[model samples]
Target: MERKIVKVGNSLGVIIPATYLEELGVTYKDTVDMEFNHDLQTLIIRNQKTKPNNKDHLEQVVKGIVDKYLKEKGL
Candidate 1:
């Protein structure tokens, strides 16, 4: 889905749809972790409660970013 970036106070932000937030298991006032994959030109957001603080999880995130980059570049 395409969403427009709008000005929020002095910063820019996008309004995530309620359905998407529900799928992510997050809601207003809930904390989330966000990461920008510069190589893939992607923004990833994860529900903080579900975020795994482990080496394996970090490896998986990196692998996913690499895979997306490769797919986008048709490597």
Candidate 2:
């Protein structure tokens, strides 16, 4: 589905179809994570509350684990 960018108060925005939003299980006021793939020239969106499989999320989890371990070991 193609959508045209329209002026939204000053910034340009695209109006996402309600069907697509419903399929994504997201409604107004819900947060989403958006990433742009430079190579593919695409935009990817995911529900913020969902478990992320991205590298940044993985690094955060690892850092948390390491921090907890260091704290427990009093190091």
**Which predicted model would earn the best lDDT?**
1
What root-mean-square deviation over C-alphas does model 1 reach? 5.1
Supply the global lDDT for candidate 1.
0.92
Q: Which window of 10 residues has the lowest lDDT sum in candidate 2?
A: 44-53
TM-score of 2: 0.65
Residue-wise lDDT of candidate 1 within 1-75, one digit each (tens)?
999999999999999999989988998899999999999999999899986769988898799899999999999
Clashing pairs in 2: none
Clashes of 2: 0
lDDT of each: 0.92, 0.87
List of clashing residue pairs for candidate 1: none
Which residue segments of model 2 deviate by more than 4 Å?
A: 52-75
What is the Cα-based lDDT of residue 30 in candidate 2?
97
